[model samples]
Target: MGTTHDEAAGPRRRSLLQAAVGGSAAAAAAGATTLTGQAAAAPAGTAAAPRSGGRFDGESPRFALAVLPDTQYLFDADSADPDPLRATFRYLVAERADTNIAFMTHLGDVTEHGTEDEIELAADTFGELDGKVPYSVLAGNHDVSGSDDQRGDSAYLRAFGPDRYARMPTFGGASPDGYNSFHTLRAAGRDWLVLALDWRVSDNGLRWAQRVLDDHPTLPAVLTTHDLAWAEDDGEARLSDNGRRLWDGLIRGNDQIFLALGGHYWPPGRTVLTNDAGNDVHVHLTNYQDRYYGGAAMIRLYAFDLARGAVDVETFAPWFLTRDPERRTPLEAENVELTGPADRFGLEIDFAARFAGFSPVPAPEPRPASDVLVRGTVAYWRFDRAGLPGAADEGAPVADGRVVRDLSGHGNDLTARRLHTSGDGALTWSAEHHVGQPAHASLRFDGGQGPDRGALLSTRRDAPLNATRFTGGYTIETFLKLPEPFVGEHAWMGVLSWEGRSGDAGKTTGWSTEEPTCSLNVSPERFLQFVVYPHVQDADPTSWSHALPVGRWTHVALVNDGRRTVMYVDGSRIARNPTQRSTGIATLGKPFVIGGTQFAERYGQGFYGWIGDTRIVDRPLTPRQFLTPYR
Candidate 1:
């Protein structure tokens, strides 16, 4: 297929992606150019055509929305360090400010660090974004770590806003910040519950959500959980498995959960999955991955015309504040009607007008028995700081230019040694932490070896580059022991990297192939990207990945089952993929680093933390496997 390639295509891809997700360039490329004001709903008589760039927003349309991750870091110090909000502040402004977006919602982890100053700083930073954009935030595992059980988050409320089973008003008003971490917004006519689950916290969080849904049984909803519910790794630890009870209690049994999926860090950023009823629900995850890739994970801006049920998605990839790219709409609503009948007469709500008077005009236009629907997503990231501990001195611990070898380590024994942090940062424990315990320490991996006293983080397996295996699904499970009542930074777990050669670059692919399936990272410091799973089709012909869990001796695994890829936490399946095939092949010349990646963009040039019982099994494991209690 030696077709003449288009170089400009890359730039164009960037341009299209930027606007699709509502980025700086996205606003500019979009026809209107003004992201602040609402897109004037065109005359109903006109062809309800979507805007040119496929992006639209309303200032006070039926509703407003936003997405923010890890606000707790605002005041929380790195144990004995104070970089003066240099990194955090830049990150805050990058996503919410420098780049333009419709709404900005905080992803939680908003300072359960327990220091008064840290708490205040967290409040101040959130407040900084209040007036700029409509703000909404959810609670992370860290948000409720201390004794108050998130009661101490009052400062968070004081600065940002509140939500917990709230309703959408058809008029003007601000978002209330209190009670819990979930809410709804009715943009045009349909209702969308901005349901944000409390990650790494109490199982009761799910029960609280169930009560909220029980109170409003009929509302259609979009469930947003911080942890990757459908993660495609191994060892079982995803919320979907560990928290299935919660899902059963709140979402699965209900019809309101129109869509479910949202986890940061990894590849295949955009994805869509239908529920049992086959509704065209959507989900999104991005890299803003703080570990391996040094830039923002990126996101796609979404605009919905509920009145018309017409959605225009665009990509937004600006300078530093990166937004992901627009994916081909994989699934659509059966009727593809944005507006339907919504009659307020006699207590009846017609869904017609809600779809922009979408009455099917019979034109013998390939009419099928029923309707068709496709699903997909948009995602990316933005890396702000780098002057931490093991940003530079870290590198993959495997042999250079080596192919696949036994990661289980040593003389083909299938058993591997755990990669421990080299006193690199707080990630290294003076002693050992038990399972299910709060973690006050973390390994900050950036692209530098600054004024920190941490040791170099690296692995022990370094095989030859040419002899290593390549092509196929591989599983690496990580065991962690997180603090109880899990919340904030203490929440640990994630995979490091599988570089081809070079530190974080692919030796074979980087040097020859077009698609370099190399360099990967998974970090917990940025709760927004508490997880990571990446994928790419036919890039030269390979794709690489890595994932992790912040705190807890839990197993985090990845599996490429032909097309149906799966991720698991503690043995329970968390995510699934339908594109990449499982060839049982992989490039392993690059040793798998721990505590971080081979190169720390935000994760690590090398790891700076602790890893134990690291197992790399060739076959995929199920959730029940994790429950069996390691022999």
Candidate 2:
């Protein structure tokens, strides 16, 4: 799906997430890279992380690291340019936030006036994260703003490298560097919990958060710090302020204190409430320095899933024109219902070392210390997006000979289409049929987060192509949802992508975008989802995720090794999308039958639902090599 830079203009397609495993199949028709240039280079290909947000392995040992609270950016009160928490710090440098993420702390001020160059550009962008995801930082009050601002506390300890108090390696092991320490960490596999509370200093982070939750009363603890304790018993010395009697003695004595992340308080708390020995706690308050990129119009994606026992909340903002609609509305908090059983252990995963290694990749950032390119030209507007010829007016293939011409999308059906759902929402489409069948435009419309119906037959492209230097290695396959028995189905479907990092449709762009995607569903229980992109703002790569379902369909793929992203689901493999800033030129607009624009008027948001027997192939396939070519 990559055409439309004006074969006469107006139906645009181009956002296969910028391809390498998929769109680079042309690399802008032979130039190798230069759809235009927003640059920030580091993915000429390889070291992975660019497939398309989904999977990073799981049988349920469970893994996550999308945390960012009390994070700041400011920009210029005393010299602040933290570029608005660079969109959740590019999701903590492309997620895994540190694999089972038993590490990652910030309940500090990170920036308000924490100057010294906004604490060294937020400690060189959190030192570019990805040590699997290990991190550490603390210094709120806008990074030492009180006590008469102790002279900017030595520029927030030489730029957030750590000071106001140290110690955070499982807490007390091999280091002696912590602000209030006590760590035990092992991660998804087990061991759980760690505590790094220093709240500047007073009541001194509740006696090391009560000797680190009395030495882990049943595991899973997380009491990093910035502060939260006001239930009005009038303690008022501020900071952890007694955080409501240490959150009611760790919520009537532990279910593992749940989670209480905080920041320096900007538009902080709105309500996290949870009680009755259900023990689930949540205070998570954030927004500082002006609140990065789309600059604090609100931002918090939050989660806590003991295998779906529940606990999920959302609160995005940045459609701009703000002054407070509560920072432009959008506080969707509801679905945290998994109810019972969710501790699977991701299955000791050795799968013989995952079928034979190929995982090691963490040594890059040491090249000449900063090319400083994340290239610029945002909000650019020069649409030649594809139709380029000049080697003497080239133009003639594409009658439909299987597809492939590159250098900016080119004529029609660029390849790729599939979507099917039902549970009373119906949706189908795999075009021209044969290979698993489809041609109904399928259907889905239940609403409320699912069988929330489906339907996608893509060809207009637009999955994130700002126009070139689009790095390489790309792929995308389909089929997932495999499992039926719902003449009255219950909702779920798959296949939908956008990677372009969309924006515009009511306006908003404070940064952070992976662009609404979805795939592999129909689970009585089985997982793989990309429903991300909103570490606080920046969205509009195009969008896809009609709720995916249709039972027993199985198969899914995405392999862009530009910087991290590799999600498969049937041929096994699951999740990974690490830092891929789209290259553009992959559309699906207007109603060219829902994707051709200039008419349907709503492309990126409506297609109805249904897909089957589709194909976007060029690479990444392997469920016995895509069922041995469908037998």
Model 1's TM-score against the true structure: 0.34
lDDT (10s digit) by residue, model 2, range 1-631 = 0011122234444331111221321222232332111112233321223222333443244445334555554433555545434434444344443232234565666665656766766676665543434555655555665542123336665554344223333444211223344456664445556565545544544554566666555565666566563211111122244466556655435545556665544333333455545433555444322323423323333333443344344333212211121222222111001111110111122221221221222323211101211122111110011111111111211121122122222233333232233232222222111122222111222212233333233334442321222234334444433334434333332234443333322215423222222122332233344332222223322222223344444445554433334555444454344354432222324211211111112222222222222333323334444321321
* Predicted model with the maximum lDDT: 2
Whole-model Cα lDDT per candidate?
Answer: 0.35, 0.36
lDDT of 1 by residue, 103-135 (tens): 444444555453556655555544543443444
The candidate maximizing TM-score is 1
* CA lDDT for candidate 2: 0.36
Show where candidate 1 strays beyond 4 Å.
1-64, 70-103, 110-115, 146-179, 201-203, 230-243, 264-270, 276-280, 291-300, 307-310, 313-631
RMSD of 1: 26.5
Each prediction's RMSD over C-alphas, in Å, is 26.5, 27.2
Error of 2 at 404 (Å): 17
